[model samples]
Target chain A: MEIQYILEIIGTVVFAMSGALAASERDQEQDWFGAAFIGFVTAIGGGSLRDIMLGSYPLVWIQDVTLLYIIIGAVVLSGVFYKWLLKLRRTFLLFDTMGISIFTIVGMEKALSLGASPEIAAIMGMFSAVMGGVIRDILTNEVPVLFRQEVYASACLVGAAFYLGLDYLEVERNTNFISSVLLIACIRLIAVKYNLSLPKFNRQQRQP
Target chain B: MEIQYILEIIGTVVFAMSGALAASERDQEQDWFGAAFIGFVTAIGGGSLRDIMLGSYPLVWIQDVTLLYIIIGAVVLSGVFYKWLLKLRRTFLLFDTMGISIFTIVGMEKALSLGASPEIAAIMGMFSAVMGGVIRDILTNEVPVLFRQEVYASACLVGAAFYLGLDYLEVERNTNFISSVLLIACIRLIAVKYNLSLPKFNRQQRQP
Candidate 1:
């Protein structure tokens, strides 16, 4: 399998797991449905938004049925293995970090290929990497994690910058993609492990 | 004030009232916040979605602060006048129909101005006119009214077609816009009065 395809599958599984975890936490009768919905949104929402924004024809998932089946399968499996997932939260986080890293790079590449400027491409990458989680949070009535002071979007931005740098250096495409993904995954994993986050806005009055 | 702008304001108010009503039915402690969230979604979600899809800068309400104030005010007023709103449901429906009419034409015009093809422009118009209500429904945990074999999206599509037909005939802009709005409002009101609806899809059959 192509490396990008492999990365996408990993991302899909991680996203589905996060959704299942969230649904289980809700502790409601609609747990299964909610988990499935969240999982579907987490797996496809970002790409769907990107396609709409870019005016891409026949949206990505619409063109590929495998994505739909994968989302469904992952959600069901995760729900059934809920206890196992609870014990492996750290493992899930690692996968999630890796997923977001690969997704950010893929988003940037797609946007650039569609002729967006670098700034817009970077923004698109961040949106694609985080929008699913944002939508999932909103649906679950939680303030989206993105709204909190976090390194989430910043991580995507830094990764995008690194990718752009490699491009400017005329790096080979496959090597550049791999390097960018690894850099983002490493940064994200370390940040999570250390509980590193962006500084919150200072709301106190300041003297000149 | 432009008639379109006037209708848009009316639409926002009517949609806000409907949202508040739905939220109130939930019997929750955060009913006020729920109402406000729904009201805001009903009032502005479609336009926000449209702007995002079109890559427009400074999303409509984000540019116009007054829209936020209006929705907030509406939510508060609705909460205070819940009994009165029950009595005015029919009047609210009329306002909503008018709002949808104006929005359908406005959305089509915006799409055309943005250089979208006619078919895409028509679809955008329909989407912009009905998507707010769809989002409101989803958030409230109700199935969207649009997909229920309703004449909702059809009304917008008809109005868009009317506008395009008049434009093709070289009619005056204001005349075309007004005629299209009136046509849509009349059709929608008639549909509501008679409980008219499109044919529902059978699970065993494909949509024609």
Candidate 2:
């Protein structure tokens, strides 16, 4: 398989795992509906938002039935194998990070192909990479991960910069994609491992 | 004040009351954030969705600061007067019906002004009338009122038809608007009173 196809599959699996993990943490039964909703959001929420913003017709998911089947299958399998997966949080995190890395690069590439400026493409990429988790958090009535003091969007921004830099240097497509994905994944994994986060917004106290 | 402006204010007030009622029912504290979110959705969700679908830029809320202030004020006031309002559910329902009626008419008029076909305009009107409640429900993690087996969208459909009928008869603009709003409100109130609903969708069970 082409490296792009391989990356897509890896991203899909990671996002699916993240969705399943989130649903499991909600203390709700692993029902088909809940699992499917979570999985779908994790898989396509960002892409859908990007499509809407870009005025892309038919939407990415609507154009591809394979994605629908993948989402359904992933949610069902995750629900069925919930016990075993929960024991492998580290594995899940690795998958999730890989998914985020690939999605960010792919999103940026798509935006650039659509004639968007580099800055717009970078923002779209980050939005597409993180919007799924944000939507998931909102749906679950939790503050969105994007609003948290984490290296989420920042990682995507850095990865997009790397991708652009490699493109400017006339690197091969496969090499550029791989390097950018690896760079993002490494940054995300390291940040999570060390509990690193961006500074919180300071709230000014009011006198009573 | 102009009749249209008066109707808009009435709609805003009633929508805010509906939001406050829902929040109170959930036993959520009447905090500023929760109340503002609810009120904002109730007042502008439909219009915002309509604008997005129509490709209107800047969004309605982002353009109108007064609407935001009104929602904030309404939420705070409702919270402070919770007990008194709870005892007036019937009155609130009446106002809510009126709000939906006016909103439906306004949405239809806007869609028609934008030169959409009658079918699309009618659909937009229905969506614009109910979308706020749907967003509010989703945010609160409740099944949307639209998903309920009810004549909710039907009311808007009928109102749109009424407006078109008035237009065909060459009625005055003011008369057409008022009649259409009243038609929707009356139909909705009667439907609610009689526990009326449309037939449930039951296309097919999953196929293996």
Provide TM-scores for the models: 0.57, 0.59
Considering the two chains of model 2, state its CAPRI-style docking category.
Answer: incorrect
Give a tens-digit lDDT track for model 2, residues A1-208: 3778778866776676677567465444333444555677678878878878888755566456577677767776776677777778888878878888888889899899888988899888888888888877765666788766488789999999999998999999888988998999999999988999876578788799
Quote the chain B TM-score of every prediction. 0.89, 0.90
lDDT of candidate 1 over A61-88, digit per residue (tens): 6456677778878987876777777678
Q: Model 2: per-residue lDDT, tens digit, B51-75?
A: 6666657876798788777777787
Tell me how each candidate scores on DockQ against the true complex: 0.05, 0.06
Per-residue lDDT of model 1, residues B141-170, tens digit only: 765555443667788888899899889999
What residue runs in model 1 are displaced by over 4 Å at the alpha carbon? Answer: A26-29, A203-208, B1-17, B23-134, B137-208
